[model samples]
Target chain A: MKIGIIGATGKSGSKIVTEALNRGHQVTALVRNKDKATKLFGGTVTIIAKDAFDITKQDLTNLDVVIDAFSVPLGKHLAYQHIDLAVHLVHLLRETETPRLVFILGAGSLQTDDGLLLDQLKKIPDSQAWIDTPESQTHELDFLRTVTNVNWVGVSPAASFVDGPKTDYALGKDHVLYDANQKSEVSTGTMAVAILDELENPSVHQARFTIRNK
Target chain B: MKIGIIGATGKSGSKIVTEALNRGHQVTALVRNKDKATKLFGGTVTIIAKDAFDITKQDLTNLDVVIDAFSVPLGKHLAYQHIDLAVHLVHLLRETETPRLVFILGAGSLQTDDGLLLDQLKKIPDSQAWIDTPESQTHELDFLRTVTNVNWVGVSPAASFVDGPKTDYALGKDHVLYDANQKSEVSTGTMAVAILDELENPSVHQARFTIRNK
Candidate 1:
């Protein structure tokens, strides 16, 4: 299958690229920093150097799935790009079914017994600086929910997303996922594997799903 | 004030362009069809030919206000362009306060005595074929209300938005506006006048307002 990974040099993106390549799918790293992307992939991947918002449909043509693994560190002034980029990509794909989009969103939009996870995060210590990304991402999913003409799905990692290796994954929907001991976590490798698995075998449609390392 | 009107050849836009000109404000008509727009304005208005979705900040740089009066005939195909174009324009002005945007929205998003006006519109016979435009525009407003950084203000005409000459106008917020006769209606001329008044006076900010023929 043909695939494009936006922000493919980032943590989750690099893992997804590796997982996709290991499964023999052709991967194109759609990125802005060609030097960093080339260094990260060691010239093993195809590259398209352009800002995500500037990416045109012609650049997206011939792909089966476009994984939006784009991310910025939390608290960045430009955190709103998370929502802006999602809307830009959706606008490009309107009224089309090909090149299914997979968005990597945060858990803020997920519903818990209390309410939205975003509400809970706001109450945490020093969440102000980092909460904008989650708020913007939650808004991204909200915007995506209103769009039906495009083929799109969103994936959210567990509450404690970390940089680590893959594990057997547990998939859930619209809630904070937890293990028996109430531990909620998902490593980048586990997220990549679960995402690749979903891309290979389509399950959910026009909705988001959550994954946890099990 | 220097104002730019998207869809300046359309019913509402043409009127707004004329109103802005009559009020002594410089106006630019950002439109798709150059010939039609030139025929409409007769060389009185400056014209920038391009699809609304393709409009860039460079084209809008010097404008003090951008009136997004772009609309499709009720029930037209590709109605989702309403939301897509709004998203595109907002993305262009993200994190900036300049170029205060004025969106001409449908009354479907307004509140009714029972619930959202869109709920009532959905029950109308054969609404499926034409409801997409209002639905998308309502979603457009929803998306805009979520934005905080951009200087955006939306205006929804009354329940019965018709094309006619200007009359005494009354402005309200959120709810569908009605006159003493219990008639909820607004002419394109009235809408244009109210918009120009708002642009010159800067009444509303980051929220939506409604207008009706009084």
Candidate 2:
């Protein structure tokens, strides 16, 4: 499978590229800087040097999947670039034979007992920069659902994600997964594994899934 | 005014220190690490070392105001610590002459259009991690309202915050603040200004305020 990653130089995207390559999949890294891409990801994967929104119009439909591991840095433009890229990718995917689109979403859109989009992020402290992304991502997800015949999966990480080993964590649907004490935690590696595995299994088709370590 | 700040090492706490000092208020930084206390913030500010939970027994009742900037890294722990710390702070504040106990809360407690707590966050694309802290911050806000005499103010940040300059943001009551286009963004500096201003003015006393950049 030839996969195109939108933010391949980011922390999460770099891992996604590594995992995709380890699985023997042909990977294309879409990034703004080739030097940073070379420094961060080495030479194992092919690189696409373009802004997230301005990729050369190729037949992206022939690709197996497009994983948006792209993350806008803390002080960059709000979810502006992210939404633009996702919408463009959706349009590009519509032209391709690719059957699935997987996005690495933040955990902000989950519901509490009150059933409101948890837009008021207070619990997962380290990822406060993500607080704004969910509101825009929610808009993007809403847009994606309106499009017909494009299968999409939004994979949100747990409340706390540390850069660590792959723990092969469990997955939860609709509800935020909590441990025995009802705490939610996951590693970035395990989250990448879950998304990639779902790409192969299709259990979480057209739905959002959360990953957490017990 | 002599002010004591718990969680002085956190984003909110550091701001409290800066704001209080900038306003010519005598400030004390209550932290867990003495070395980081000297490095991150300098020595002119008095540094008191203690666990967040242990502050209840400290002689904080004499200070003009006690701001529990102390927050568990939402990504590191669920809202358990936040709830526990708030509950304890409320009880301790009741014993002191200080009339106000300001809490930096998560946006999960804010009421949505449906009049429910926006606790579910996984549905949102980028904020999955905040489900824990925001949910817990909501609980703390509710608990603060039940107490008498000790005025509590819960300050929830808008969608995204970064190391940006203070842009003179606006304040919303019980609802999330939005820009002209309804998108929410706030600089940490402006959030600090709003919070410290609230501390002096006492508007929205015994309630919560959501802040976003203009």
Candidate 3:
């Protein structure tokens, strides 16, 4: 498979690039800084530095799948930036003839009993830094859902998304991710694996699902 | 109308108490800290100090509407402390024969196309702090929707929840609130008014709705 990863230098994005490469798939690492990408990712994959929106159909024309791990800061109000990127990507991918998209979403959108989004994050303290990232991801998901022509899958993490290796976990659609103790904690490696699996198998098309340790 | 305001000493909770009082409604302010309640609220309404979990039918036996402004953190890996409070309040309200519940929710649960929670926010430079509170409120809405016996309405503010007088904005259900400019914003005072009006009129029952400028 040919894969293009946006924000390939990011913690989670880098994992996706490496894992895709390790699987013997051809990977194009889309990044903002080539120097940072080289320092973090080394010369393991093909690296392309371009603005997410500026990348034309020619940029994505040959890729079988596009994985966006692009990031902005936590707590910066950039709904338009994120949403713009998603909308632009949908447009760009459609024009480029790309068929599949796999998005990294936040755990906050999991269904409460009545289907209200858990994005308000009242359960988490305000002092934490990563809280806002979920909101940005959710906004992008909303925009993507409006694009019916695009086949996309939005994957959210568990409530506690710590940095660690993958574990034995299960996945559920439109629900919270639970671990062996039924607690929600997912590692980035597992999340990337789940994304790659989804990218390969093509389930959960145009839907959102969560993955956690079983 | 007779209204009960839970967690009436915190920032938004205290504001709820005042709004209920100003609207000429009989208000019962529930809180844990009597000293803070006394110092901050100063007897503008009836104050009942008790552990939120211990709130009983007798405490709410007389109220017509319960505006649960009470809140607790979602904890490190927990959904929210308020989830228990919401469940407890619904249980008590059902026993006490109270008819309606008006909950203040965070916007985190608002859905994008991929069904991600909007509240899982990432900070973008030049964004405001108030934009993320709606996600938490959305979680509360989810908890409230599970109860069949209680009539409830969850009010989520726009992306920017400004503190000001009422503006009489338009209302939306299960979608982001956007203005003519496509940017979303709302005032806390207007959110209070809309919630109060919903309590009095009782439209869009058992659903989550949003408020934004006209």
Choose the strongest candidate by TM-score.
1
Question: Arrange candidates by DockQ, highest first: which order?
Answer: 1, 3, 2
Q: Which residue segments of model 2 deviate by more than 4 Å?
A: A1-214, B95-99, B114-117, B125-130
Residue B105 in model 3: shift from native, Å? 29
Per-residue accuracy of model 2 over B1-214 as CA lDDT, tens digit each: 8788888778877876887788988887878998888897786688888877567445586677777777766665435567557755665555344646778877677666756446445467766565666666665676565444466777888756565667777888887677889786777788888878877877786777888988
CAPRI rating of model 2: incorrect
Stretches of candidate 3 above 4 Å error? A95-97, A114-120, A123-132, B1-214
> What is each predicted model's overall lDDT from 0 to 1?
0.92, 0.70, 0.70
Using DockQ as the measure, the top candidate is: 1
Greater lDDT among 1 and 2 belongs to 1
If both were scored by DockQ, which would come out higher, candidate 1 or candidate 3?
1
Task: For residues B1-214, write the lDDT of model 1, one tens digit per residue.
Answer: 8899999999899889888889899889999999999888887888999998889989988989898989888767788888888888998998889899999999999999999999999999998988988899999998898889899999999999899999989999999998889999999999989998888788899999999998
Native-referenced TM-scores of chain A, all candidate models: 0.98, 0.87, 0.89
lDDT of 2 by residue, A29-81 (tens): 87889999888778787777986656534735556788888777654434544
Candidate 1 lDDT over residue span A1-214, tens digit each:
9999998999889999999999999999999999998888876789999999899999887899999999998898777888889988888888899899999999899888899999999999999989999998999999899889899999999998999999998999999999999999999999999998999999999999999989
What is the Å distance of residue B151 in model 2 from its true position? 2.5
Error of 2 at B100 (Å): 1.9
